[model samples]
Target: MKFTGSIMITCVKATELIEKRQIQSLTLGERFKLRLHNSMCVACRAYQRQSKTIEKAISRWMHITNNTTHHLSQEKKDKIIEELKKL
Candidate 1:
């Protein structure tokens, strides 16, 4: 199937396009083809959903880590390291 300036993309191509969309903007033709594939393909749709869910989760985790100032005490860190060595 044609992907860039053409029509009809396969499931694999569609999923690749989905991932590319997350990192960069897709061309009009590429977006059209991906949407067409998603309309008819259940697995691709599910994959897209799962990808978005993971992206959101990672974004949230990063945001929380960046904004929070929770630091472990030196004693806590040493204790944890000692416990790990015991294993």
Candidate 2:
């Protein structure tokens, strides 16, 4: 996890760490590397934001779908399926 001239982890590694962070807490080193990388990499910063947004949206969706008392109409379910498939 050396910053070197590139400032830190590669974009690929940054993306992986970003996703991994959603599943578990990152190590101190991992978080430091990710923060450094994001600070210098515009694309990676955007990716992090997008990844967080997607995770939050999915979490909300899961909560809604898992509520047995709040049933979705078949038509609404179908629409949801169609929209998800597009993604």
Candidate 3:
């Protein structure tokens, strides 16, 4: 963080920060470094975009999968509904 003000984070570090950012909030210095790096590094900017797209896709897939995971047989559902009606 001491060197973050003027020094641009390396591509590797920038990419790491970008990934880290997807799951967690960054420190002020880390945010600064990432912004500095992305401002001047076109490749890192592209990488950030790609990383976000991938993360969103994975997140959406997980959400969809989770919702569908607790599958029930049609017979089981019908029994449950009939029991609920009795209640």
**TM-scores for every candidate against the unseen true structure:** 0.58, 0.55, 0.58
Top lDDT hit: 1
* Candidate 1 Cα RMSD (Å): 8.0
Worst 10 residues of 1 by lDDT: 1-10
lDDT measured at residue 30 in model 2 versus the true structure, 0 to 100 = 86
Q: List the residue pairs that clash in candidate 2.
A: none
Candidate 2 lDDT at 39 equals: 86
Write model 1 residue lDDT over 14-51, tens digit each, in one string.
99999999899998788888888899999999999999
N/CA/C clash count, model 1: 0
Winner on TM-score (2 vs 3) = 3
Candidate 3 clashing pairs?
none
lDDT for model 3, on a 0 to 1 scale?
0.86
Best by TM-score: 1
Q: Give a tens-digit lDDT track for model 3, residues 31-72.
A: 988898899999999998898899889988877756546678
CA deviation > 4 Å runs, candidate 2? 1-7, 56-87
> How far off is residue 51 in model 3, in Å?
0.7
